[model samples]
Target: MAVRRIGLTGGIGSGKSTVAGLLVAQGAVLVDTDAIARSIALPGGIAMPALEAAFGPGVIDPAGGLDRAAMRQIVFADAGAKARLESILHPLIGAETQRQAAAAGEDAVVVFDVPLLVESGRWRAIVDRVLVVDATEETQLKRVIARSGWAPEAVKAVIAQQAPRRARRAAADAVIYNESLTLEELAQQVRGFWERWAKSSTR
Candidate 1:
């Protein structure tokens, strides 16, 4: 049976994770593409063989998992490198995302929590609705720096690599402005979003 799939997305530190959690509490089946990607790049995982074959040992950590830091540096510095890495991972991610969504069964309201949904171009066609968790670049920088201890330039680079804030908003069917809202307030908004887009749609 065809399911109602929601593409939930946001830039780094936009509090997308919190929205995802709240949606799960509202009973959405969350198929997190990033989590799937990370798992497949782990030691002895499906994507590891291809990653090793393509990028070689230097991109592999001593524990046999992907050296994400090295891979990020390579990808950011070269568009071709980014494309090469995505070519390897995107197919794997799509397949796993499908597998997980299928496993959710016929009645599930599946949310595809994809951070790179807008950048990917294909996700808009794949899901029923696109929901963006939005924050200003300044807020994103402050939050990520506080949480991850990444330098401002590092966060800026990451933000630059993603779809622009305006672009993300344009891609969205619904937008959650997450910059200054409290958790309970955010949860309240998510509840409203859930009632309208997810739970009601399932009916």
Candidate 2:
């Protein structure tokens, strides 16, 4: 049985991670792009040298790992800087994600949890289905601000970098409304999706 790869995405604070967790509990293999990105930016990771060259040594912590907060501020404040960082990191992350997915082997329904799936465009071709977790923009803003203690303006800035909710929804093959559901309810939805996916893919 070939693997069924699903791309899981949502705007910041839209509870995509929560949905990923639900899928994991249902026995899906999960690969998180953020985690892979962090791994690649760590001291001895393949992308660290390019990151250091692009951002200078100051972006590296005393412990030699990437100072994620410092790097975040730099990229978030400058569009060119963000693009440079992405240019360095994105390819590495994508390659590593594919490596991980392949290693998961056949028979696993692998879920690639990528925050910018719709924005990237490339991801659509790689995955069997795009599952978007969604919430109102107001809810997204409020949640990010509350959790991160970011100013409303900062939260909005992050939101601006993401594809609009309508665009994301339009691109999605499946949508999970995450704003009002309890974890139990979310788990049920994941289980239902899994059952259907399993039956269809096998046929």
Candidate 3:
């Protein structure tokens, strides 16, 4: 039996991470793309030097590390800059994700937590299912602002760069509405979905 590959995605602050954590607790081997991206741009990671070369010195902190926040600000404001950054990082992230997925054997139901699954387009063919955790844009804005202390405009800018909510929801094989659920409730939902998903995959 091959492991079932699940692409899990959502808009900013849609509680996707909370749900991913629950799935992890339930024995799903989680591969977080954001974490992978960050790691790749960290000091010794594969993509760091290329990133520094592409964006120049200011993009690197005094410690000679990628300043993620500064990069985020630049990419969020400039499409070309964002594309350049993704070109450097995405392939490295994808390679690592594929390597991890291959190492997790048949029983592992691996969840690839990607924030821009739809926008990337490359992941669609590789994944068995795309699970979208959804919330209204207003909810997303409020939650992001509250959690990250980002200004409203900044939060909105990030949101603008993502695929629209409707498009993401339409792409999903499963949808988890996360607007008003408690952590416990969200966990229960993930468990329930896994029960059904696991059984179906085995058949």
Candidate 4:
């Protein structure tokens, strides 16, 4: 079968990562952009040269990798700096994403686990379906605090920056309501999707 490209997204505290893992276990090739970005920003990675050229050695650590903490602080404080960083990283990430997807072969179903799929405005045109993991804001805040030790305000800020739940739902071809499901229950939901996905792709 031809590859079914799925754009998966959710807010910070939603179980989107968990859902991605489930999909991977079901034989999906997961192309995670954030993971690719981190790998490329590591010492000697492809993005470092341009990144360093743009931001200078100040953003590079003693170990030669991008000083993620310093860079995070810089981007957080300056929107232009954030845009500059994105300008350096997005193309590299896009290239890598394409390479990985192509290499997944014709038979593999590729799930692009993009955190900002809805905000990007371009992903919708590429992917066959957008699967959004939905959760209430309160549920999101509590889950993030429990999992990451982030303060409530920090969680709130992260959620505030993401496309709203309504917008994400509007963009989704399917929605997985993840507010209160157990891991096993969520897996069941994913299993159902997998069954339908196989049949849908052949149509």
Candidate 5:
């Protein structure tokens, strides 16, 4: 088998990261875009210079890392700010992701865990398969609230910004309905997908 890629996406608090860990356990090379983005926003990170230049010093913390909460407020409230951010980070993320992908060698199952894959549309042409981990909106609300200690309204706001459940489903080659499954059940599902995936499954 040659190298293959699976584009993984889900709404916030939809267990996307959990599913990603499961896939990694199944021998997939994981290229987590969000993690890369976070790394680049850290102090002295790759994206910091441009982010500081674009958004100014107020968006940086005393520790010199990105003031994520402030930036989140800016991006969420201002569409132009969001686009400016994507412009600054996307190219760097893409280049680094590709560089990591190139290191996978032959026959590797590369999983790109992108939270915004459905919303972005750019990943559609690149991946062999798209897998969406899904849950009901209410379930998502509850899970995030439970885990993050964020205000329910804040969680809802984030959820509202992401592509809807139906939209994500439409983009998927396979879907994992994660509304109420235990971790073991989810892991079983990932293992099943791993065993069954092949070039023949391409659309």
Candidate 6:
């Protein structure tokens, strides 16, 4: 039996997490790549040794974990550094993601909450569908600032670095316009989506 996988993605502050949670409530299994990445970067975690060697001691914190903030600054400024870093982490993350998805079992509707799904073109082929949570760049900036306390310019920079809105939309099999939705409204939309797919997957 094959698990039906949905690749869910959105820009920062676009409420993708909320949608993921709602789908989980509807009995969907979630394979969160970000959480897996964080876990692998923890002290003595699987990716730490390779990270330390590739990026050097300076990239590791005193606690022995990868210093994500410092590494972010390094990679974003240098494409080669970013590529090198991804080479060390991506394979590890992909393996863990696959293991988790497999453990979710055959009947599960697995939702892969991938923040960079659009940028990672490979994900599009692996999942049965792409569900994008969308909002205007202005909406994204304001929401991120309000929630994360990030500077408006910093939020804009992240948005700029992501695959553009048009590209994400083009890749989407379904879209959740989250710019003005209340939590209840957002959950309703997610629930409807899950119902439709869950019903169809059985047939």
Note the Cα lDDT for every prediction shown. Answer: 0.91, 0.87, 0.87, 0.89, 0.90, 0.88
Q: Compute each candidate's TM-score over C-alphas.
A: 0.96, 0.92, 0.93, 0.91, 0.94, 0.94
Task: Report lDDT (Cα) of residue 53, candidate 4.
Answer: 93
Please count the clashing residue pairs in each candidate, in the order shown.
Answer: 0, 0, 0, 0, 0, 0
**Model 5 clash number:** 0
**1 against 2, candidate with superior lDDT:** 1
Q: What is the full ranking by TM-score, best candidate first? A: 1, 5, 6, 3, 2, 4
Instruction: Give the per-residue lDDT of model 6 (tens digit) for 139-175.
Output: 8888889988987777877887799989999999899
Candidate that beats the other on TM-score, 1 or 3, i.e. the better one: 1
User: Considering summed lDDT, which 10 consecutive residues are worst modelled in model 3?
Assistant: 194-203
Where model 1 places Cα greater than 4 Å from the true spot, the runs are 1-3
Pairs of colliding residues, candidate 4:
none
Off by over 4 Å in 4: 1-3, 199-203
List candidate 2 segments past 4 Å from native.
1-3, 199-203
List all candidate RMSDs to the true structure.
1.8, 2.0, 1.9, 2.2, 2.6, 1.9
Clashing pairs in 5: none
Residue 19, model 2, lDDT: 87
Query: TM-score: which is higher, 2 or 5?
Result: 5
Per-residue accuracy of model 1 over 12-85 as CA lDDT, tens digit each: 99999999999999989999988999999999999999998888899999999999999988888999988889
Candidate number achieving the greatest lDDT relative to the actual structure: 1
lDDT computed for candidate 1: 0.91
| Residue 59 displacement (Å), model 6 | 1.7
